[model samples]
Target chain A: MEITPTRVNFEFNPHVPIIMDSGIFKAIKSGGSSREQAIKSMYEDNKFRTQLSKYIAQNQGNEEDTKDIFQEALIILDKNLRNGKVDEDQNINAYLFKTCKLLWLNSLRKNNKIQLIDFEENPEELVTNEDLETFREEGKYKSLQKALTKLNDRCREILVLWSQSYSMKEIMKKLDLKSEAMARKSKHQCLLKLMQIIKSDPNGWED
Target chain B: MNESFYTELLEIKAQGKLNPEQEALLTSLIPQGSDLSSELKAYHLAKQAIEIDISNELKFKFNEWDQKKKSRLFRVDFKTISIAASLFLFLSVCSILWHSNQHFSNRRIVNDHLHKFNTEIRGVNSGPETLSDRIGKLRDGLEQNPTLVIQETQALLKLSVTGVQKDAIEWTLALAYLENNQNEKALTLLKSINANPDHSYQKHSKAVLDKLNSNWRVFLF
Candidate 1:
């Protein structure tokens, strides 16, 4: 039978059975496995992309951080689905709730939280805790964006377009740089100095 | 504030790659002298203002979310769940909270439903005399052929003696209690209805609960 929301009474409270069945024991104990399989399949569903995208787009945060958080949540979901951490009689909604909460707490706690998630490493995964901090700083690139304006008009135009994905050749042609290589390296030094000024007031630019 | 330190950070930060040791150095080296401290404070204030600006946008999204959740009566579908998760994370990324206004309403719904229950039940007089009289009848009834289903039905309707059986006979009695605005009795029977786990009227019970939670407004309507 298809389970419905009204069946959320594994106990009266939502948090109860989560504590009771957290993956260590009762998941695939004896006969019940199909339910577990169905739950695992449902857990990794990417169908919610629209809602996730809308929420991220609407928020003030950098899209990259939004991506980080969503990615971690997905990773957690995949790991849990692979493990016997689920039961057919279990509440998938509650499991999602707890999983999301823990992932969020991990996001808050720096890289330390990664170890807490009991999982085998995915080989292609390059986004680590360090990468999260990097994304965080990248999100604060706005500080540098603001600081670049402190430079003269030519510097501002050159830097803004560069930040916006203009290539070195494009910037050289556009800004009338001495040469392509000069534009590339000088633009680098200019941006570096500009970022220095921004980072000088470190309290404000925290990612 | 030297160019080299900034360049180091810019390179790694631009790559969006930093080990803990490097990040530690960057964070620790942020000067705290009087001039620098004051500048940092101003920047913090400016950042707060920027956050407020962004918060307005987040609130719009939150309200949209609230409306969607209200319409959704079934399971927390993948869409809704993901939106909630992403929104929560995005707000965190923004360093701002998008608290659901539902906290007050969620609590209020729970309280008012419980309150309506209390008011309707009015409890056969909260006195020992009434209690003893009811106890005596209940004891004698127990001695009789245990009308297990009937008792369960009565308890479910009363919203007391929860986990009662849901037989048709019991339901008739429960319907009677509901018609009479004997909400306490109805609630007890409803609790009994919970035992089936797969009862047909489970949705009906939830709808009734939502209606009841609305401050006795159902009766007025």
Candidate 2:
């Protein structure tokens, strides 16, 4: 089998715009410490957290609410960025704030909590309806992930490496498989087993 | 295609290693609304779920960081803080200017390539409304009505298509995505085309990708 060598680069240039759907973003997709570093920077950035805390507070939320909403916003942002839903030039801070606002509003509406303040912001400025729809779709993945945890350790390891773009040769070496073909077959079986597990659960994939 | 062939294709796809020809073959072989297609969708969902799993791990790490940060004590001198603030301001200004220039240049380069692609499509669009002609029209319609073009191209992909026809349609669809400012989708399609040695649009796709990568490298370094 002719295996293309995987490109491995450890250098993370802090100057590159991490929001751009290229370059560093591609590095993040390929998965490594760079992705972790980028997420850490976003998490630790006080400006975004401070702005969101103030917004949530003004809208009748407490400190715990601010932290929870902020964390959810970060997840949404990270998912959108990975899925290419975010545009290159879009303001990340504004996007996160808008997502938090929308999520909080949905939560309040669900709880039948009386509105403390009028959120008269332009609807267009909020995250797109498509983004909300995508977020809904993501809820299914959480269930699927529950199914994933049921897989045996070796199967889980194989599937994770495959998803991370590891080459068959590397997987073969790491797993002590006889050949690349065996590695490929192992990944295929693991995926099929995961699918079977998901299918077996009556409530596994319920939307 | 036979059952084994379909299974092989699905396996390759599950590995995320399907070349363009194999992708087209799988599309042609799988019956619409069949169990096979659902299985393929399951595989896709599983892959996405794994990615979400990875992100969740990161979220766990973030929680750890939050706890650790809360527990840590910080002490800073005013002079040190002042010097750091000054340096940050200077670097921020420089970074803003550099990023603006890079963004502008990258946009210009992308526009130039799209213009070239438009011309090429027009040259191929003279015939009647076959698969290629429909793709050509979709490319032409991208500027005037991108949403319609995107819808039409997506619908077109559902129909059974030959390998070369699939390549033409996908290339045009990628361009339409670019026109619609969906860079991620466009990049995915372009990379697929460039990876497949037998893909009809391989050369053009490579050229565009090369330009894009060069610009990214310039921005990175």
Candidate 3:
């Protein structure tokens, strides 16, 4: 099945430059309702999807890869544009494709795949402050997700409940434990177990 | 340092229940310029990951796109009436013709732009040789000394910025990637040039991209 943007909630007027003059970039940068609108707009844009699909296909990446690449690229572009890294006269569409290409290519390189199309090299170490932060968060998230997956169901539940701010008394009541001490011990033990798992995995996180 | 005290500190931190006295103690215990306790940091990270579900959202969007594509395929394949199919075929033919025309025009424009760009850049007076000079040299050495060129290009590219110099360096780096058999990176760079009409070396870059893509098609198909 080929991916296409078949559903558009509103007409996208190409004549109107939405990247700069409009508040879409600002909204994306601010993140919230405006960001959601920008994401939806990007998802609905036929050209944007096509560019992603084409590049992904050409690079031996799948549709899922396209989705991640597209989102990350948009985030970087949003941040860069806000910081004036992208010139005002530059075409936003071009910037999108360019950034997507670099990210996807970098992913391929990281995976140790030699297969790449030589369009041009990404000079100037394209990683941004936002990208570094995102990478750190991604690493931490992956490590944590892995550790959580390895835990017993009860331990996972206990830790999750504690993280969500349940007091020992509340947790004991909710989980039908014997006492507050029991809930506290269980939560503490669960945290220890999670930490152990994360620490054991050398590749779990990177600064 | 008491290990149990550290453990208790982490436990309270994870639960967001650290009192002012406990927080002060934690601040005192933790070495300056060091991160928060490792266990506590891990716990918090995992907890945030679970609560925010940022990774999960990525998966959700991918699934949505996949399902939409499948449904579209099913609809077009099984439910399209003969009249609609005929119209579709007609539109397809029209699209192909129009696309071919645009391709030829784009090629001409790219060639013209490259000629002008080359002329303009060549007119810039030569300055003292530096890292940019090495990038230029690597560009020339890409076919001759691919490994060394790639090494130099990567080093130089890391230090370059966005401008005519960086653009030229990127162009060379792309060539280095191609020479080093990293076709994916090369293709990506070429695609950027092809897509951006206002790129510094837009014409020459796109021309190279077109050639490479054509070769790729032959190689793949």
Q: Report the number of the highest-TM-score candidate.
A: 2
Q: Is candidate 1 or candidate 3 better by DockQ?
A: 3
Order of candidate numbers by DockQ, starting with the best: 2, 3, 1
Chain A of candidate 2 gets a TM-score of: 0.66
lDDT of 3 at B35: 59
Worst 10 residues of 3 chain A by lDDT: A5-14
Worst 10 residues of 1 chain B by lDDT: B97-106
Give the number of colliding residue pairs in candidate 2. Answer: 0
Scored by Cα lDDT, where does model 2 land?
A: 0.67
The digit string of per-residue lDDT tens for model 3 on A158-203 reads 7655543456787798789999878777776676666667767776
DockQ of each: 0.03, 0.18, 0.09
By DockQ, who's the top model here? 2
Q: Whole-model lDDT for model 1 versus the true structure?
A: 0.44
Question: Per-residue CA lDDT of candidate 1, range A115-186, in tens?
Answer: 333343445432233322211354354554455445566655555444333567777888888777766666
Model 1 lDDT per residue over B1-221, tens place: 34335334434543458787776665665545434344344333332222322233333544455466556743557678889999988878555212223322323333333333333233532444443344334323432323443454456447433221223324334444554446687678767764556754454456555555564353233
Model 1, residue B195: what's the lDDT?
54
Local accuracy of candidate 3 as per-residue lDDT tens digits, B1-221 = 34336557865776688999998887666544545766566655555444434335544664686688789988777666766889999999889767655444423333344344444444541443464455555545656777786677667667755667666666666666665667787778878876877767677777766765574334432
Pick out the ten consecutive residues of candidate 3 chain B with the lowest summed lDDT.
B105-114
Q: What TM-score results for chain B in every one of the models?
A: 0.24, 0.44, 0.40
